[model samples]
Target: MGNHDELICAFLLSGDKPGRELSWQEVQDWTPDQGNIWVHFDCTHPGTGDWLRAESSIAPYVLEGLLADETRPRCDSYDEGALIILRGVNLNPDARPEDMVSIRVWADSSRVITTRLRRLMAVDDIRNQMPTGKGPATPGQFLAKLAGRLIDRMGPVIDTLSDQTSELEEALIGSEEESNLEDMRHKLNELRRVAIALRRYISPQKEALRRLNHLDEDWMEEEVQGPMLEVVDRITRINEELEEIRERASVIQDELANRLAQRMGGTMYLLTLVATIIMPLSFVTGLLGINVGGIPGSENPWAFAIVCAMMAAVGIGMFMLFKKMKWLTIPK
Candidate 1:
């Protein structure tokens, strides 16, 4: 939409009936007698800021927050309403869930205004259900349902991370093959990045939900408290689970590093053993091959065979000594 058409969608809800769409003109003329109103806008649109400044009665700080390009999850309560910020997994095609999408909402007893940079599936879900009379009937229900929806979508993403981490842990235990560790390292890094990113938002999101649940507004009804608490609890669990996943990724990384070091140590030990045994043999061969006629092997072919046999015996003796010294075997 353009600046002149800033609204993405508007809804008018009645406790006695289902919600219906409201046009820009209707939204501008909406009165408390018309039941609750929800106006969703694409904040990036050219005229969105102008419309909010000129039409909405929201506080200056909340207005600035809603129009801002970036915001963290938070809730600021005001006498008129509360400016609440929340985030949901970026479920859009090609977008990573770690790059969460923010949904800024200003809500009170009778009106709600939400803005976003990208489409949120949770918002769509509520919009779709409103026609079926299954949507929130009041401003409090709206906030609670929106919070619930945002948290519900997060469950699957968190579960996926946990499941993948568990599988990696199993793989680490079963085998530490070089190629497998390489691939595991890549996946573990990605998982750690995702977990950290998610925890960054989810932690504040839980607090935001709690604040919304306890908002001082009359519209924040007692019935909404239960669902809001549930949302907060779920977000809290997601944060804790993300931390676990991150720790597991760290363990996987350490184990992989240890395995690589062990392999390298074994290879180095074998190379060192070969060099140790060959050093004396090479010295003897070089000394005998000297151009000086005093060299004993120069005149007798049997002398060459004797030297070869002696060198072989020396190599075997060195090998046995190394085995007995336990240098040939990897340390426990």
Candidate 2:
């Protein structure tokens, strides 16, 4: 059942019947009985089922395998239910690579099925909360638990990003170091990408949950609705926060770039000014060094000193002119 290509689905029987995990063969052989809920995972064809279906190709294991290196977050819905996909952020405060984990889940009234290519904190958090004695009564409740866990996991990640951004902003104010700017740009871009991916899923998930709230199915119990609504509200709030973070990151990036460009422009301006002042002196020296016998300064020993004095005077005069023209700025 743990085979890479094997699919495993478990069913929790209703009433007082004992819960049993069934393999695909056992599920196919069993007769349909009332109060019995079935869970099936088909490794070869996830698309062949009725009521609920998840293609192995789209199953979490398979999808994770295919998109292991994919970092983008997204959300989509299918005929069976809704697919909420998102990237979970790594919140290590140390400067580490920003690795994002992708989550894909399908949910309906009777069952919630999840697929992922990698282990994500949100999934593990919910799994840890599952009761040892009993499984959730319906798929919708399971989904609510998962969503709530996801929102909970997001808090620390967002807080970490916010802190890092604030620190970068302060650094920008005090230091002229380009490294700080570069790091800020890199982090901001990564944050923006993650936010965009989250938006892709969180936005649609809000609507999906709204639809679920009004669904015609009797399988959704009153006990689960409260939690489900709470999950939806949490998701909406998180989405808003992510959007705000994205906007702030964008502004910071732009400001950093502009500051860098200004510094570069100032340095270039100084270089150009120095070159302008040196041009006349270079011409004088070159003219004096010519091979011709009639060169103006070559005949006199004191001529070299005179020319040096003239060059110094010219440089000073030009510096004063530039100062008067207000071309130089005081370093802040």
Candidate 3:
């Protein structure tokens, strides 16, 4: 492999060495006659855009795509080459896997140029294969291998999402406590959000690959189409799995919400019954406490005891009446 810091990675594919790394100066001096070459670049490099436009002689539209700040999964082809944008799950440290990383590629018969703002391990995978004769030998093979790598990495991430969804569903099923349902609800929503984001990119990327595979460009050899189509089918399956995760999450979240609502309603029902029982007692105490001389209990020495006894009876009576009517009982 070439110096990653210097040229990102530039390799010449020739029969003698199979794949040979090239320096920055060597890449600048490279020609079609030298050999079919693959170059991977960190688009953030200060000289990348300039070198692409000037020395590399990349067309304006193609250069724009290679250096664009934002892109979605897509494919476009001209007479000479095809430009493709594909997204892979973000597996970088401290990064959420749903926040996918994008790779931009331009490939023809003689050259294949790939760019990325973030590190795509799939590129590293391709470079690793270079030493072996098993590495990509043509532009079509390069696209196929890189695409296969990106989709392959998505498999574990999609599986994890499905597993989490299943766990949450099981937790909800066996649970009797409403105490942690709120927290479970939050977790469920987060899972749904991640599934949606992954599906958004994967669905479109499947279409992008399908479009690229069907293009009439000479660069896309017949043998490479098999791998490209495999990539399309893999992404489509990933998309379907994500959609299933979202649907399952939604159902679990709704169940959690219903359980919480039932608990809240039960609490409110008890509070209402207590308030009803206290209302009449409050009115009696307030009326008797008035300072008017016509108050009946004010002159009696035992009036305080009698009033307390009477108030207790009233409270007891109310409770009995509520029980008889089943108003104090919680419904199933």
- Could you say which candidate leads in lDDT? 1
Give each model's whole-structure lDDT: 0.87, 0.60, 0.85
- Rank list by lDDT: 1, 3, 2
How many steric overlaps are in each model, in order? Answer: 1, 4, 0
Please give, for residues 235-265, the per-residue lDDT of candidate 2 as tens digits: 7777787777778777888888898888788
lDDT of candidate model 3 versus the reference: 0.85
Q: Per-residue lDDT for 311 in model 1?
A: 96
Task: State how far residue 213 of model 1 sits from its true place (Å).
Answer: 1.7
Q: Give candidate 2's total backbone clashes.
A: 4
Candidate 2: give its CA RMSD in angstroms: 5.8
For TM-score, the strongest prediction is 3
Clashing residue pairs in candidate 1 are 3-47
lDDT of 2 at 98: 41
lDDT per residue as tens, model 1, 98-196: 899999999888888999999999999999888778888888999888998998899999999999999998998887567887888888888888998
For candidate 2, the lDDT comes to 0.60
